[model samples]
Target: MGLLVVKNIGLLLTMSNRLAIADAVVVIKDGVIEWVGPSAEFDLDLYQDCTVIDADGGLVTPGLVECHTHLIFAGGRSDEFEARATGVPYAEIARRGGGIAKTVKATREASEDQLFELAVPRVYSFLAQGVTTVEAKSGYGLDFDSEMRLLNVAARLDKATPVDIVSTFLGAHSIPAEAKENRAAFVDDICDRWIPEVAQRQLAVFCDVFCESIAFSVDESRRILKAGLLAGLKPKIHAEQLARTGGALLAAELGAVSADHLDFASKQDAKALAEAGTVGVLLPGCAVSMCKPDFPDPKLLQAAGVKIALSTDYNPGSSVTLNLPLMGSFAMAFMGMSAMEVWEAITINAAAALDLQDFVGMVKPGYKGDLVIFRGADPVGPFYEYGGSKVAKVIKEGSVVVRRDPCGGVTI
Candidate 1:
């Protein structure tokens, strides 16, 4: 049996009902947390071979989980950002054959080996920020060949990166260029052809659709999501980003694990989300990147008692960020969410959105040994330091993955 101990934790954010634990010690055995409590209560001689880590006054918390991101794709869209900043709307650019279509074209052109190399550095960038698990979607590949290749590339990335990757099939991200004239036909092809193939190959865990006025209409969204559900693939929706098209209600109806990009959610959407237990994932980085006039109203969702989570929305066209702290800070400053709220959003709440809350979100006994140790005395420093790296140590499955200046430090 293998054992690991982290002791002398100055501050521990358990992310439980009790919220915080002070002067805590966590014990792990065989990749699962065995004990977590005051240091005085932990027994040192419980295991045979052991490894001890000192977290000395540093903050220890569950590893951050990013529930929504389009991390796998070919090329960059920095040029699109420049155009959008200079008084151009994203929809107008898309009408001119830009946006997802542009990436779709590029992604389809690139080989799997080329895609893998570009994405490896990007995944490491996220890991440097203390992110341990990420849900990556294949929306850039809006066609069968490209979409499948993107998912295949995402699967390949798991072996190449330290961060745990979850892939989703998003063939209905947008109607392809070939199917531009017959959008419904494209939807039918996705449901009949692409989704089945993806499921047969066991490539994706969930299926998603972009439910918007400019993208898929309300009926189309419902139809595609329904097909995905019937195929034994869980459903998720990119809903209400540009307009309130009852996407939240549709997610509730479909029993989706989560619905993301609710920047334009109405009161009814908020109410439906709360009642349905559908996690409301807010992407403030998208707003920051696009310079949108208004951000999502956190108060309305919070008032409705909706479970809200924050994500980087790490995509090429809109949000080019991969840092969860930056996204959390944006949620705090612009969305008016508190630090505690943002913390919960990325940790426990984000885990729940990905259906991984039972093990990964909390640093509790019997949970997956996934936690981060920040360099500072408090957790807030990770955000307050802003652009600097605060990830002192990263532990996944009871194994130390990333450590900074690892001579000697505190452990809890």
Candidate 2:
């Protein structure tokens, strides 16, 4: 809330072409970055009334940003998790009344307080791992009333925490069983009724559709996305996760913000995405959990000049993780990416996925003062040591929001 200065940083990963800086000084005033450069040039007279934080020769970086997650639901899907791991077809599981449907039933029965309580702990988990901003989707509530309630719960969670929440409307995640008799009617309901209501209320910043074989068809997905666009929300898609249903090509055609989970996306699709300047988001965490063979080709995507991002996909059914560091490790070992690439995937490129790169992804003058200070000597320590954190402090909006305990726990 006041002037703050961070000095004596051993290493700073700026997510810029130059990447790393040494002996850096960062100056913040009124929650925005005022200056960043070598510590030798820091003007002492400029910060006479500022709070100074010595970084103790440690690693500093822009706070992590999570691009995709499904943390707003009632119950866990451990049973479906096991079924998928054992090679059961997801469609069959859904038909047997066991997948997202099961969770939707539970979410509909849960009250707003219950939903908010369930979501708060998850936010803490993300913050402990150094994620300062995250995108949360409302897919479990496919109907109007529950869907609205889910977004409202997300709003409440945002108000209750320092971590910024970006709510996404995913009403086309699946077709309700009751609507199976006339899927057309259900699609119409989403385009004609749901999009307008969510948009008018300003409950969500973006609208996403599950454009897969198990969910909406290409035509259906396009219609839903178009309706959301008309209603003034950005468009994104859960494209090519299981099978290529023409989602990626469609995303590029319309210049959507991102096409996520492109496990089965072709090189042609990657090229299209690159040309359109759409982000190609990979979800290696979900691939590892689901044992998916066709993990996205990061090298190909990179060669095509596409900006790549990684995510936890922190849903109960597929990727049951908020540990993005682990996801980074998985991206390197399994998705054929370098440590620098993985780091960029979660920072600069990930910010682009949310259309917030200009504001939050860099430690530059005029950017938001969101940063992570690690106790280690190098910025890569947090990604190198998966399932662990070397974070000494987490700053959001120029204020210290989280500090590490001596016992390796987080405190606020």
How well is each residue in 18-86 modelled by candidate 2, as lDDT tens digits?
468899989889999998989888887867789998888998888899999998988777877778879
Model 2 TM-score, all chains together: 0.97
Q: Which pairs, if any, clash in model 2? A: none
The CA lDDT at 179 in model 2 is 89
For model 2, where is the 10-residue window of minimal lDDT?
287-296
Residues 289-390, candidate 1, lDDT per residue (tens digit)?
Answer: 786757777788888988888999999888889888988777766778877888899999999888888978888887888888877667677776675667
> Which residues of candidate 2, in runs, are more than 4 Å off?
86-92
What would the TM-score be for candidate 1 when compared with the true structure? 0.95
